[model samples]
Target: MSLDQAAAVMEQQARACRNMAAPLYADLLVHTAEDVRAGGPCADAVAGWTGAPSTAAVPLRLLGGVHALVLTGQAPQLARFYPSAGGAYRPEDADAAWAAFRAVVADRRDAVRGWLRRPPQTNEVGRANLLLAGLLHAVQESRGLPVRLVELGASAGLNLRADRFRVAAPGFAWGPEDSPVRLPGAWRDGVPGWLREAARSYPELTVVERLGCDVTPLDPGSEDGALALRAYLWPEHTARATRLGGALELARRVPARVDRVGAAEFLAGLDPRPGTLTVVWHSVMRQYVPADEWARVTAELDRLAAAGAPFAHLLFEPYEQDGRHRFQLRARIGAGPERVLAEAHPHGLPAWTV
Candidate 1:
């Protein structure tokens, strides 16, 4: 691809970052876009890329790479501009911060390019809020049956331990008070009556099993794996970083296994047991799966449903509805029809009924 084309891709992602309240990444991305257009180090970092920009998330890959450099102490000059590294991004010092970021990309050119080869790996813990909500709905529908939780594209299997995380919203509260991962203000407007009642009725969840699949599963217990997860976080958002820290810490105490396999392959081997409710769930990772493979996944889900052995399918993914992109929490139980339980933020916060 031409340098100008790549630069445009960077600019597009910059707009996204701005919209998502990541001023640090937005500023860096905008400056990097200019560098790419000027055929500077940023251009070389993304040279010869030929995929749909949004699909590849090229800008995020590059920024995450640079963030890793700071986190790992490879680019100390850039660390001061990154909050995740105990530094701050000041609007008044934008030029100086850009200079530091540019220098890092130029010096660590190969490292930035290495990151471009891999897609962004962000297993956002905030999304667990929505997933847990769906799981609770599933449990309630299945009459308090012990759940066999299965996740597709669960990066670190962190959300597999969603049951253990503390969740609080208007008229709704659950999980251990002393839990490390605490999701507060979950529903923006007001807690849906159904969810509130479900939370009250169940009060606690019993997850008898936790298994997930990713093409390349990351071990949250490993130093490199944990660092990668942290590196991908936008430096300015301390809350996100804090939540991830807690999830990583919790991963050590919890036993959630993520196998290395395609989603369809993983689901193909499973069938619902009589006693436990098999809840198949995924969040934000649906776009990564190809349509044909997803067809297989749906087929597998249908097979489980037909088996009629206390099965549930839960999804917290984006959908085009009501003339806008909606991030929805949808669920179905046994042979029941699927329905949207609620709509939520992409990172799974502040949910409201559809």
Candidate 2:
């Protein structure tokens, strides 16, 4: 691909970053687009890619690589401007930040190039806010049976421990009170009154098993794996960084198995256990799956339902609504029709009643 076209992609991502409240990433991406147009080290790092620059989440991968350098203390000068690196962004320091970032791309070309090849996997903990709510509905539907949590495209399975995190909103609360990963204002306008019955339908969820699948599953307990998860988070979003820290700790304490397999194959290998609520869950990752593979996954869900196993499919995936994308929490219980339970931010914070 021509550098100009690649540069436009970066600029497009910058617009998205700005809209997502990541101004630091937006500014840096502008500089990155310029660097790409100039055929600088950024171009060299992405040289190996042939099909398309966006095939590997080009912009996020590039930013994640730079974030890794800051997190690892390999780019101290650049780290000084990254919030997640314990530094702050200053407009006056923009030129210096770009210089340091470019130097990292130039000097650590191999490292940056390696990051370019890997897809960005953030394993966002905030999304657990929506996951937990859906689990609540599942638990209620299963007649309070023990939950068997199965997730598709679960990166490090940080969110597999969703039940372990504490979620609180106005006049509502759930999960352990003393939990480290505290999610406040989980529901928009303080837990909508319409869904109070479902929220209180079950005393508590009893999770018996936690299993997930990813083409490339990450080990949260390992340093390299953890760094990859952290690197993908927007550096300016300190709240997400803190939430990740808590989720990582929860992952250590809460044992969950993430199989290194495709979502369809993973679902194909499982049978629902009797007297247990099999809750199949996934979030945001649905977009990456091929249409045929995703159809197979849905078919597997259908198989489980036909088997007469108490099952629920809870997902937080984007759906087109009114000519735009909407991140929705959809749930299905025991072959019943799927229900659109709620809506939330892309990061899955502050959900509102549908």
- What are the lDDT scores of the predictions, listed in order? 0.87, 0.87
Output the TM-score of candidate 2.
Answer: 0.96
lDDT of 1 by residue, 136-158 (tens): 88888878999899999999999
Candidate 2 segments exceeding 4 Å error? 53-55
What are the clashing pairs of model 2? none
TM-score, per-candidate, Cα-based: 0.97, 0.96
Clashing pairs in 1: none
Instruction: Tell me the spans in candidate 1 whose CA falls farther than 4 Å from its real position.
Output: none
- What are the per-residue Cα lDDT tens digits for candidate 2 across 131-216? 88888877866668999999999999999998888888888887788788989889876686535666677646788999999998
Model 1's number of clashes is 0
